[model samples]
Target chain A: MRIAAARERKHDERRVAIVPDTVGRLSRLGVEVVLEHGAGAAAGFSDAAYAEQGATLTDLAALAPDLLLAIGPPPGEVLDTVRPGGLVVGLLGLATDDAILEAVAKRGLGAIALELLPRTSRAQSMDVLSSQASLAGYKAVLVGANLLGRIMPLQMTAAGTLTPAQVLVLGAGVAGLQAIATARRLGARVEAFDVRRAAREEVESLGARFLEVPLDAAEGEGGYAAAQSEEYLERQRALLAERVAEADLVVTTAQIPFRQAPRLVSGAMVEAMRPGAVVVDLAADTGGNVEGSRPGEIVETNGVRIVGASNLAAELPTHASQTFARNLANLVELMVTDGELHLDDELVRATLVVDGGEIRWSRPA
Target chain B: MRIAAARERKHDERRVAIVPDTVGRLSRLGVEVVLEHGAGAAAGFSDAAYAEQGATLTDLAALAPDLLLAIGPPPGEVLDTVRPGGLVVGLLGLATDDAILEAVAKRGLGAIALELLPRTSRAQSMDVLSSQASLAGYKAVLVGANLLGRIMPLQMTAAGTLTPAQVLVLGAGVAGLQAIATARRLGARVEAFDVRRAAREEVESLGARFLEVPLDAAEGEGGYAAAQSEEYLERQRALLAERVAEADLVVTTAQIPFRQAPRLVSGAMVEAMRPGAVVVDLAADTGGNVEGSRPGEIVETNGVRIVGASNLAAELPTHASQTFARNLANLVELMVTDGELHLDDELVRATLVVDGGEIRWSRPA
Candidate 1:
């Protein structure tokens, strides 16, 4: 069976669905990997690298394979060029991709939206969200530190002693924990907050202090954070504001899936921060965790910089694409056997959004 | 005794000669501090902060005092506003600053050039070059990592293992060693090269491999790497090119005092770097260590990013200014005894570039 990916067309989407390392994995599975010319250019994967890995570099029109891969959902024009009844897989933002879902249904094609994959240990290797969020968490601290006016680490020089910066990371999930780890590695005194009590051990394991909030049972289905009431959010923000006022760098990653990001920092809180303090909102694309933050922009309030970070993982395109390809390759390992594809595994079945002229998945309750 | 500083006017210069922390230190020395309004604003110090430390904030014309402070050389008009025969201290770039030197000499005023200060144990506390270079070194890695297309650290995620980046730092001087430390903190495997054989121990202590070239006696006076012969530089470049090609990030900080920075990474070497690799030249302002590097700009050659980092310490203005002010204060401590300024100490005499209508110091032999 042949699998192929065209160059990602979405602006600011630097990550490709395939990398050279993953090409060998698919090739080992008796899969012919075809890529459109310049498909991995933005992600630092040259066509030569793919060719060296025994993958074919061809025109978009000639990329009619049995399976099509993408980072973003491929446009209808590209989808129409796929082989009849071919399968397509990507981070199909199912909630907002009605047009692609309808087109796939009408064409009797198969679609696998990785975002809908079950968050289980058996499917952990294919968990793109966890992988990408970890990168976003790491990038958030880097972005904030880059904007800060002082060094993150302390120095006792002949000139004088420079105190370490105070870093406050909001959330204790994959991204928040990674942010804490990165900040701690840079010698910043890190403090993290999360409604999920179970995250405390993980946060402390990284040598960071986990701050406690009074509310409990904020854990949602699949170990993700559930939405909170307005009163709970108000109390949480009140506690965070005091800590944020003293932070040199703040990275907020308090995101609830398929919902607006919880606002954890108020405008007054940002204003209270000293000049040159930086706040990076990892949830900026889905509303924001800080007031006055806009997607993909930096807002300054009273000498404090609030960066609305969107698609931060994509900024580290080479590694982002590497892990993304590996995730897809892992799923392919389960489905492809004896040089033939079978969609029998429960892990594979869970990711199927559209198949056999019918929509297979719906928004989880 | 009174000391005052005017806001810097040079383009791209963000550091102030005095920070609020040093104002308190000076105040205890019976020195009445005066500052032009917003003198430290660019460095994140406010008038209120200075005022809290018993410093008077006023207009530039009204800052008549016994001593004037600056980051860059104060322009003629501002220098003319100082009290007659009063002292001025700053990084007076004596060699190329003919106009400022002439003006100071013509006015019969005393000037201290921090760059020319003796590098001795007694003067170590007042070593502005080492202090600022340390900050620049730390910032160089940050700037390079920010531009890189992959994460600096490694990760073994469920998706796959992401390898740590290979960072090559050239010239194991103050800046290069700091860059190595910062990269190692971020989990990058660093390799550093230096003409000075003595730098190997320091580089290895920071958990980085030292790439040694078969050379001897490269060390100059005062523990600084001296200028090398043309043949030595040519041989060094040949050795560095092979390592530079394999690095994900390269930071070059090989600078000779009062001399052009040696070209370590040739244009051909940069072109050999893979796409998305980054090179930050800390000596960019002093004729770059990398070929085609323009001061204060990012030059992309063959898809490799070459950052000509000028005044990197100024980018971290808060800490840069804090240490700068402390250095100046330490110098003041020895010169200003019993509430009066004296120019008697050998260390103080070593820094005097101009005094009594004559240039007191000349280019080193």
Candidate 2:
């Protein structure tokens, strides 16, 4: 079987699904790896590096492989090239994009969407979302620290003692946990909040204080914080506002899959912050968790600087691509058995969006 | 006696010589504390904060205090406000600018330049250069880490192990030591170089390797790494070129007092570095240690970023101002005893630029 990887067509997307290091791993899976000439260029992977690993370099249209891999969901034109029963795999955005799933079904293409992979110990190695979110969380703190007008670390000089900056991270998930860790590393006094009780332990384990609110853990499907009731969200807003006002830096990573991110920080909270305070909103791409956050823009409101960072993982393309490519390689290795598609596997069954000329997986509305 | 600090007039200079925190200290020196309105505004000290500290705010030109305190040497018009026989104190740049000293002599003013303070244990608390340089060094690392296109820390993820970034710091002064410490804290593998042999122990104590250059320590006047011979500098450059090419980040902090900074990282050396490598030139304001560095601009040469970071301490205005204010206060307290200028003290004699209508201290030619 021929497995081909294509360059992501999205303008801001710099990550490639298959890296040069992963090329050798896929070759051992009893398949020929074909890549578009400049597939991994943006991620600092040269075409020569890919060729060094014995991967064939060619045009995606000319290769017409039996199996295809991508970072984003391939457009309609890309879907047209796949023969009947050919396999297509990527993040795919199958969580909410019904049109892409419908197109795959109509074209009789067997598509596997990594976003649907189960959040289990066995599937952790192939969890692309967790890997990318971890990087986004780390980058958020760096972005905030760089924009801040004062030093993050405390210093006692001949002049005077400078206090460490106080950083408050909202939503203690993969991204929030990483932000807390990075901030703490830079000698910041970090505080974090989460709807999940389990996140409190994780936050504290990284030497950060967990902002306690009088509410139960709103555990949702796949161990994520589920959407809270209106009353709970209101109470959360009130509790978080006080912490936000006291913080020198705030990093918001509250994201709900396929939905508008819950608003946690209000404009009043931002206004209460001292001048030179910085806020990095990681959920801005999916309709922010902070008031007045515009995606991909850094806005100064009153004295506070609010950065709406979208696709922050793309900014650290080298490592992001390496981690993402490994996740793709792991998923591909699981689904391909004896150089052919093995759809009966539980992991494969969970991710397969279309099979045998029909839509096989149900997407969340 | 009246002590006054005015708003700095130099472009891009945000630090104030005195802050609100030091107002009470200055009051203890048997002097009335008066401040120019908005003196500490850029450094985040509110006018109300200064008022609460028992400082009277008024126009600088109108106040005309007995002693004038400033960060930079004020212009002729600002100096004109001070009554002849009154004192003016600051980092007066006596090593190079004789015109300021000549003007003070011509005006019969008692002037003290902080840059000429003796390097001794008693004078350590009043070391403005050391305090400000320490902050500059710490900031250079932060600036480089933020601009780099990759992560500084190593990560062992399911994807693969990402290596820690390699950082090379040139010069081992207070700023260089601080840069090494900050980079080490961020989990980068740090290496530092210096002409002073005493720096090796300090560098190694911070968990960074000291790049061993085969040469005798060229100790300069006043306990600094003095200017080196042309042949010695050529040999030093040859030894550093390979390390410069190998490092992901190079922070150049080599500077000589009142002279152009030594060019350590040649343009050829910058070209040898890999694409996306960053060089933070801390000496850029006094003529760069790295080739192609412009004082206040970030230059990209052959895919390597060379940041000409002059007055980086000013960028961290809050702490920089606090530290500078304390240094100024210490100098003022030492010089003014019982409401009179005590020129007999060694510290006072060393720093005094003009006394009794004559240039008391001759500058280095």
Candidate 3:
């Protein structure tokens, strides 16, 4: 079977779904690889590199293969090129968009989204979001550290002694934990808080003190935080306010999937911080946890600085791309064999969203 | 000897240098404690709590204590009340504030900063910065996860499958590493990059891929990235741009003590990323490693978000305050005896910045 990897239609998405290294790996597995011209350029792989890796260079029309791989869902034009019963795989943010799924079903095409893999131990190697969020977490701390007005570690010298800075992290998820570890390494004091009880041990294990607030834990299946009651949120806010006032830096990361981020830090809390204090809101895209936070903007309140950043992983590209490639490679290796596709893997079956002109798996009706 | 615990001078600070539990511990150590009324109120302790813990509530001027424990350096008024040869210990960020040290020296007082403890294994309990930074790192990742426009892990449904989000972490230091681990736990694909080669194993051990860039491995004495030549910076930037273009989120945590953060992400590099991408900068207060990144502001370049957060630890305040209190208590316990004072511990020697009108044990020149 032949597969075609094409350019992403989404604006600013320079990364091709398949890279030259993966092409070599695919070739070793006996799968025929085809590429649209310069598909990997944005990620630093040239068409020549794809050729060197044994992938055939062909025009889009001539390279119409059984499967299509893209960084995002296939655009209308690309979707029209797929053969009946063929598969298209990539990031299909289907919850927000239904047209793509309709298009796949209309075309009698099989589509799998890499983002929907379950958080199970057996699916660890196939997990892509964990790989990417890890990078975003590490990068956020470096950004915060760069903007801090004072140094992190204390020093004693004839000139005078310098005190270490204080840092507070709101969410104890992947990105928040990484920020704690990075800030600690830089010699800053760190503290973290999370609603999920399971997160407490992880936070403390990283050597960060976990702030336990009196709030009802509402975690859904798979350990995701479910939406909470207003009363619970208010109590959580009151408990957190005293701590917020004492921090020199605060990073808020609490968010629920497909929902607006819960408002955690209030206006009074921001007002209570020092003049030069800074707050980084990671939930700005979904309505921030901090009051007066605007997505992609900085709001200064009572001399305290509030930053609402939308996406944090793009700041470090080289590593991000390499990790993306590795994860994709691992997934590809699991689905291909003897230079052909193995469509029967349980992993593939689990992720297949649409096939044979119908929606195949279970989801919100 | 008589000792007084004064109120913190900083308007936003609420944590007292000595908490009620510690006051009880100090009382058992033969240390006479005089506390300013309402000193521990901000940290959720009442005057009655201090009283119950065996602390004497007294006016600052009338106390004339031989030792003073303060959350911050003593206010000018409190300092003026101290007798010659009195000791003052607290969270004085002396490295950045020379005036406080001068005040201690001029008054012929002994001053010790709790943040100056070494990072050896034996000193882990006394490592106040590590305790706080660990929390900061954990919280930073949570912030990023919440801000991200999509879910971290992939999910499968009959409607369609969701793709995993990609996360990039800049700097493999403590915070960055923790960010990597936290993001991984949340099911994001994580990649970490650091200038220090020593961090590779640590990053990898956490199950995150380490980005290896070709560069001179010139780590400083403390295993930090040393100041590099302009040529090296340029090379680092070029290499980083390739990876940044592919990430959904990027967290930057690289910084040098008392120096501007190394410029890592440029405007051109940011322009290459997908729209809705987020960047959380941990170095905004000093200067940002990302060009066009404003401290405490989210600068949107071609739809890419740059977040420069200053105080990440403050976001997780309850735990941060508790850990900081414990550190302060431990440091004081090392020098106080049965509600009294001792001036002869090696730990005290290392932390004491000024004593008897001179810079005692100051690092050579």
Candidate 4:
């Protein structure tokens, strides 16, 4: 089988699905590796590097490989280049990317949506969502600190003692936990809040304070947050407002999978924050966890800066691509049986959104 | 006595010599505080905040107080606004800002050049250079990390283990030491170089390895690096080339006081570095320590980014202003004796550059 990857076409998408290391990994599995020219340029991988690892560089349309890998669903034109009955694997958003999935089925191709990968111990190594979200959390703290007028760590010098900055992280999922860890590493006094009481253990283990609000658990499937009623959300926001006002830097990552992010901070809460405070909303690509956050733009209100982080993971393109490529390689290894392709693995059954000429996805009950 | 500060005219100067907290401190010293409109605005302090601390806000020309405070030497127009025999105090560069000093004496103003303050224990609390350089060092690492494509710290994610970034610091001054400390705080493996062998203790104390080039100590006055011969510099650069090539990030802070900064990283050495490596030159304002570094801008050569960081402490405006104002407050307190001004203190004598139409400054023997 021939495996290929093409350059992502989105203006802000900097990650590449395949890297030189992974090309070598797949080639060792007895599959031909091919990639379009300049595929990994944005992620700091040169075409020469891939070629040196024994991958062929050519136009995606001309190659027509048996398997295609991508960071996201490729454009329709690029998808049409794949041979009939071939396989496509990527973060095909099961809920939001209906148009692309429809096109995938019409083209008589089998597709593996990484987003549909089951959250089990066996699938941990191939969890792209967890891996990508970890990077986004790390980037959030750095971006917030850069934008703030003050420094993060407390400083004691000849002039005087400068107290450490107060950092508040909303939600305790993969992204939020990473943000807490990063902030703590920078010597910030970090506090995190999560409706899932189980997250408190992870937050406190990172040397951060876990805030407790008087509410029931909002646990959903696969450890993601469940939807809340308007009454519960309003009460929760009121409780969080105090913490928001006290923070020097706030990173909000309260995203419900495949749904709008819960609004944790309101405009009034932001106004109460001190002048020069910074708030980074990692959920801006969704509806946002903070009011007044605009995707892909930084806006200032009442002397506070609100960073609408659209793609925080993409900022660290090199490492993001490397980790993602490793995850993809693991899934590819599962599809190979006795040096030939097989679709019998449990992981394949969980992630395969489309069988040849048929769509296999259904809404969760 | 009346003390006044005006808004700095330089567009890039975000620091203010006075803050609201310092205004309260100065007021408690029995002096009238006057300020030009929006004097502290750029430093994240508001006019309302200053007024609340008992400061009088008006135009600089209108105030014409008994003492004038500034971050740099005031221009001829601002000097003209000060009353005859008034005192002007700030980080006045004795060698470069001669034109302004001449204007100060011609206007019969006594000026305190903070840069000329003797490095003694008595003057430690009032040492603005140390205070500001410390912030510059902290900011250099942040700028370098933000530009690079990889994370600074080591990670053992399920995808794999990522090694920590190797940070090489070329200088062991207050700024360089701070850079080492900050990088260590972010979990990067750090190595530092300094001509003064005494710096080894401080570097190691901050959990960083000190690179010792095969050279004798070049210790200068006041713990600064002394001038070196051309042959010595060439040998030093050759020794450092290997470390520079291995570093994911390099922050250069090797500046000789009142002299052009020493050239450290040559262009040839930079070309040998990996793609996406970042170098932040803290001495860019005087003269860059790295070749091809443009002051106040980021330039790219062979896919390596060179950030000529001019006034990096200004990037942390709020905290910088707070520390700077506190230092200035300490110096102001030394000038006052029992509700009256005194010019007899050792710090006052050392820092007072132009005293009543006469220049007390002579080159240090």
The candidate that wins on DockQ is 1
- Per-residue lDDT of B75-158 in model 3, one digit per residue for the tens? 788888777798887767654465778888888888887656666665666666666566556656666655554556554422
Question: Worst lDDT window (10 residues) for model 1 chain A?
Answer: A218-227
Two-chain DockQ for each candidate model? 0.82, 0.52, 0.03, 0.75
Docking class of 4: medium
Query: In candidate 1, which residue ranges exceed 4 Å CA deviation?
Result: A95-97, A213-236, B214-238
lDDT of 4 by residue, B223-242 (tens): 23323657666766676999
lDDT by residue for model 1 (B47-126), tens: 99999988999998899878888887889877887787888899987645546777888887888889888888888899
Clashing pairs in 4: none
Please give the TM-score that candidate 1 achieves against the real structure: 0.94
Comparing candidate 1 with candidate 3, which one achieves the higher DockQ? Answer: 1
TM-scores for every candidate against the unseen true structure: 0.94, 0.87, 0.50, 0.93
For model 1, what is the error of residue B20's alpha carbon versus the real structure, in angstroms, after optimal superposition? Answer: 1.2
Please provide, for model 3 over A26-88, each residue's C-alpha lDDT reduced to its tens digit, 9 standing for 90 to 100: 667666889888666555566787898789987676767677876668887888877778888
Clashing pairs in 1: none
True contacts kept of each: 0.83, 0.56, 0.00, 0.74
Candidate 2 Cα misplacement greater than 4 A, ranges? A6-9, A56-68, A73-88, A93-111, A213-239, A337-344, A354-363, B59-63, B76-86, B93-111, B213-239, B337-344, B354-363
- Per DockQ, what order, best first? 1, 4, 2, 3
Runs of candidate 3 with Cα error greater than 4 angstroms are A57-63, A155-158, A214-235, A299-303, A361-365, B1-365
Looking at candidate 4 chain B, the ten consecutive residues that score lowest on lDDT are B218-227
**Residue range A231-271, candidate 2, lDDT tens digits:** 66676677788889999999999988778899888888899
